[model samples]
Structures are given as C-alpha cells and as structure tokens.
Target: MLEEKKFFIHEDWVVVILAALIIALAVGGLILPVPEFNWSNASELFQTVLEPRNLGIIALQFTFVFIIAAIGALLNKRPLKGYLISFPIVYLITIAALILAGNSQVKAINLEAVIFSLGLGLIISNFFKLPEWLKSALSTEMFVKIGLVLLGTGIIFADILKAGSLGLIQALIVVITVWYFAYWLCKKLKIDDELTMMISSAVSICGVSAAIATSGAIKGDSKKLSYVISMVLITAIPMMIFMPLIAKYLGLSQEVTGAWLGGSIDTTGAVVASGSLVGEEALKISTIVKFSQNVLLGLAAFAISVFWTYTKHPNSKDPDSKPTIGVIWDRFPKFVLGFIAASLLFSFILDPATVSSVKSSLKNLQGLWFALAFTSIGLETNFADLFSKQSKKPFYAFLLAQTFNVVVTLAVALLLFN
Candidate 1:
C-alpha cells in the first residue's frame, strides 16, 4: 500500500499573505489616508517627498532596516552566510531595473527593493560559499555599483548643478582624501590591504555595502569583510546621531550643513537621517549631493580594477607583459555595464512624468530594501573573518580613502555650499 503525499514544504497561503501585506502597505502608504497615529500624508507623499515631515517618516522606516541588519547576527554560525551573499545581489539587481525604468506601480512595499533584498537574504542565509570565480568582482562589489547606477533616477543632476557644482567638487575631495589617509595609515601599520580597503571604503563611501563591495574587489578574506562591516555599522549609529550637533555648532547654513553631512557620512540612510534632523532644505540639498558622489562609484571601481591589473599581476615585471583586453574584460564585472547603461539611458531618454513615477516608487521602496540588503550582508559576514590579522592590507586601503573623504568633503561643503 502506498500513501500519496503532497510535496510542499511551505504553505502557498502564507507566501500570498506576506506578499499581499507588503504590497498593500506600500501602496496604501502612498495612496490612502495614513492613520493619524503618524503624520504621513498619503496625498502629499508624492508631491512633497522632500518635505521635512516626510523626511522624518523616511527616517522612521529606516529604523526597521537597522533592526533587520542587527538580526543578521542570528545567522552568523550556520548555513546562513551562503544565502546572505547571493540574495542581496539578485534583490539589488531587480530594484535597480525597477527604479531605473521609472515605474511606481507599488507604494510602501517598494516591491522591487523588497524582492531583491529578501530574495538575496534568503539565498545568503542558506549558502555563503561561492565558486572561486564568483567570488571576484562579479558577485558583490560590482553589483553595489550597479545599485548606485539604478539610483540615478532619483537624482536630478541639473538640480544638483543649480544647487552648486563646487558642492560636488568638495564631496569628491573629501572622499578621496579620507581614502588616501586611511590607506597610508594602514600601510604604515602594516594592516592587511584587502581588509583595509574594505573598511576604508565602507567608512568613506556608503557604509556596510561599500565595505562588502571593496572586500570582494581586492579578493579580501571573508573575515576581513565581516569585521569591517561591523565597525562601519556600529560607528554609523553614533555618527548619524552626532553629525547634526557638529553642523549646528559650526553654525553652518542649512544647505551648507546638508552638503557637509551628505559628503561626510558613509551610509545613505544615515545621511538622510542626519540631514532631516537639521532642516527641510538640508535634507533636499544633502540627498542630491550625496547621490552625485554615489554616481562616481562606478568610475572609481573601474579605475581601481585597471590599477590592480597593471600594478600587481605576475606579468607586471615585464614592460610588455600586460593584461590583454580580453583578460581585462574577463576580470572586470559586467554588471557595472548594466548599471552605467541604466544611468545613461535615464539621463537622456526619460521625460519628467516618467522620471517622477520612477522616483516616487523607488523613494517608497528604497529604505526598506536597503535595510533588508544590509541584513543579508550581516548574515553572510562573520565576527571571525572581520577581525582576522590577515585583513591588514585591505583594512589599510579602506582606512586611507575614508580619512581623506571626511576632511576633503567638509572643505568643499563649507566653501561651495556656504
């Protein structure tokens, strides 16, 4: 006698209900009347996205992201790391496409961001080890650049220029100088190059994500990546809290303060949080400036890849022995191309209505997806690899860039935006 059994491990109803909940909340947050419990005005959600009160709501949402990221600690020991790695990658890719395409089909859930983040998170939780080839720029760091590219729809470059071109110049100076300082300090300390780079970039750039990306770029050991992320996330909480105090103490104008915070902070969520606390004008100005620098990441990554190819390869000893164009192509991640393409296409092709729609949708989804993505990052990386002695060099590199980033960025912020 044989008993027939259904082969389902999870309930379809539960998946449907979660999906519905996410979607309904996202859309309702934007379309329906928000309960008076919070000050969110659904009617004005799209029109006044940059308003100070709305910015507060956005900040409130990011709290969830931080919590999930902290929970990543739960998955540290087991098979979760592998799942952590891949889930963020895929989830990020989807959000990129959705935002770049300018579709605000959903509201609060940010279907695209959630899909990419949760999917990636699930994968990373289940599987952390990757093939040697996948570990290179292809899987992690390059995709971060890709995420930045997709984020361009939210950035209106013309608005940035109108605000102040030198603002961008200041930001670049800050990011580069801090990075250089971090690098030099690490080298003098004889810290591992890969880990140094991870920490430095994460600190200098957009926080945990950048740290993870650089770790992959330099073939940093896993433990190095974990510790660097830990340092960045932990320090970020305080930086976000204290930056407004520094801004006001320095007597910076709202716009100037915006530029300063945007330029200085490592995480986008943190920047937005700090900026909103200052004033409405600061939030708007800071977000735009921060995005401008974000756009530069692709070029930086490319430059780094090229530099590494020429300087460190076994064939570097021979003047004529260089990576063939093919080898260069092979080593470089192709995902960045998709990111660049999305930026250029949107920059030239999209009209106002389309861009508006795209931004609205992404705005709604951005924080939540980012939160989930970082959680996945936390899940995959570990305390062991992050603190390892082998991480000295990468740590040095990351440290170098981040130090330069803070000083130079502040100078630019004060001079131009002031």
Candidate 2:
C-alpha cells in the first residue's frame, strides 16, 4: 500500500497557508496597529515607548503574533509545549531590540532592530548553554518563510512601473550580472556550494532576503545562513554611511546615486538610509529600484530551487539522470508559491484602498517575523561556527563580489539614469 501523503501537509505548504491566513486576516479588517518605538532619550523612552498605551499595543501585537505562530507550530507538528514556553522569551528579547533600535542615537546610525535581535540572542547563546527544548523550539526557517510571504504584499508591480521603468531595467541588469560574477568568484575560491549560493544571492540581490531565499531553496545549514546574514548586515553599515559621501564627491546626479545605492546595497534599510543622505529624489528612486529587485525574489527563488533540484540534490539515485517533474515538484519550496501568489494578489486583485489600508499592518507583521527569525538564528548559531577558519574564503569572496556589485551597479545606473 502506498503511504498516505494526503494526511501529511509538508512544512512548506503549512508555511504558505499560515502566511495566507495572516494576509487574509489583515485584509479582511483585522488591522493590527503598529506600536510606536521612537524615543529620543530615557525620558521619552519611558514617556512614549513604554507608556501604558504603547505597552498595551505591544502586548496586543505580541498576542496576535504568538497565536499565529502557535498555529503554525501546531500545523507543522512541532513540540507545542516547548514552543509555548520558549517563544515568549524570544519575543521579550525582540521587544528589547526594537526599543533599542527606536533610540534616537541608534536611529541616527541606521541601526535596525534585527541587528539588536541577533546581538542579544548571540550574547545569551554564547554565554550560557541552552536547554534542548529551547533549542528545538527555534523555528527560524518557518518565521523567515512566513516573513517572505508577507513581504510579497509590499511588492506592488504597478508601483514599481509607475515609479520608473529605468529602475526596473537597472535592477535586471545589476542582479543578473552581479549574481553570475559572484557565483563564479565563489566557485573559484572553492567555497562550498551552500555558502556560494547564499553569498552570491546576498551580493547580487536584496541582501538578507536573497540569502534567506537561497538557503531555503537549497536546504542550507542555518549556521552558514547566519554567517551570510552577519556579513551582509556588517558590510551594509559602512556602505550606508560612506556611499552617499562617495556619490557627492563624484558629483553624481541624484537619480544615478539612487540607482547605484539601491542596486548595490544589500539591505533595503541601508539603501534607504544611503539614499536619504543624498536627497529626497535619491531616496525615492532608491526605494523604487529596491522594490523592483524585491519583485524578482519569488522568481529567483523558483529558479534556484529548480536548479538545485536538478544539479545538486544529494538524494538523487542516479547522478546522471534528470529528476522527474514529480521529483522536482516535491523538492520545490512551496513557500515561493505563497510568495508569488501574495505578490499577484496585491499587484492586480486588491483594490488600492484596501491595499493601502492594510499595508502598514502587514508590513509591521512582516518585519516582526523577520526579527523573530533572526533572533532564532542567533540563538541557534555558535559564534565559533560562524568565524571558523573555513569561513575566511567566503568572507573574502563576499567582499570582492560586493565591490564588483558596486562598480557594475554604478555603471548601469549611470548608463540608464544619467
């Protein structure tokens, strides 16, 4: 008798369902209010961020997310008891990170909450040994996939086209050129395929998201994913701070500068920060360009999944034989489907009024999910593992690829935007 596949919903499908439900709830009028985290000082921190109303809002947000996460855990057949006990602790840590990120000084430096989340978790994990239950409860991939799905809602195709056709054109040229260059460089450096893929995607596409998508598609090690994320975040800081100054020194036009920043910078937050330093037009153009790239994430993930399935799957019985369509389908990440579906719904199906109304709420939830995922990643990662001697080659490759990305994006930007 063939085993009953119908009874078992794959974790990827569960992620898709959970992501859909979250979007449906938001669009169906359950608009969760985003809590205020902006604070200038200790006084304002207490008076504003920690005020009764804000605290209540935070509590409500936590409850909503916790419930959704719990449902995901249940559907995925995770140990509910451990997840229940551990998730709140993670949320508390993430809240502290959010508060830290809200500080005026932190905001001034363009430090994001996810950085703090990762840092705090690293501090805890490195300092003390964790219980097995807590370790098992870390649903890093689940959180990330759900966040990616939610991310799709913000990638409204019309918005990208309306903003600038040049932005989309630049995104395509930059991503394709940079990805291949990065991939070839990593291969030449003899970095393992997993790190190669993650590093390549990070350099060529939107940094963290690309890395995450690649990792998910390939079933990569979380430690490697964390390493790639750390590199992206760390490299992003200097890029964000100094790239605008470089643009000004070169006397580049705001449009070219924006295109360069958006195309080259790994992270969206960094792109925005760098663009803001140049001018309002730079910021606008940079954001449009970034969104154009963001719109390609689902397609890239699908392509990567198919490629990985065909070429690198370890379980293939015959190394020379191409996998059947059913085998490929089985190996494909279902969350990418959710991502594409969400993007399509937002792009064409939803009315502007409905989309506008629910967008902020969904975006907040998306950010929170990513923050949670990073916290889990940090907790699960060992500092030693990330910085082992083996990582040096990939690090060098990433820096070199980023440099290539910067040069190529600048060339593309000047050619198109100029």
Query: Candidates' TM-scores?
Result: 0.62, 0.97
Q: How much is the lDDT of residue 255 in candidate 2?
A: 93
Worst 10 residues of 1 by lDDT: 30-39
Q: Model 1's lDDT to the true fold?
A: 0.54
* Tens-digit lDDT track of model 2 for 1-418: 9977756679899899999999989888999999999999789989999999999999999999899899989888889999999999999999999999999888887888899999999999999999988989999999999999999998889888887699888888988999999999999999999999999998998999999999988889898999999999999999999999999999999999999999999888888889989999999999999998988887888888888888874455767887778877876788988998999999999999999999999999999999999899889988998889998999999999999999999999999989
Worst 10 residues of 2 by lDDT: 312-321
Q: Deviation in angstroms for 251 in model 2?
A: 1.1
Q: What is the lDDT of residue 56 in candidate 1?
A: 67
Residue runs of model 2 more than 4 Å from their true location after superposition: 1-6, 313-317
lDDT for 201 in candidate 1 is: 67
> Which candidate tops lDDT?
2
Residues 186-278, candidate 1, lDDT per residue (tens digit)? Answer: 767777556556655666556655554455445566545656655655455566778789888988899888888888777676778788889
Q: Could you tell me which residue pairs clash in candidate 2?
A: none
lDDT of each: 0.54, 0.91
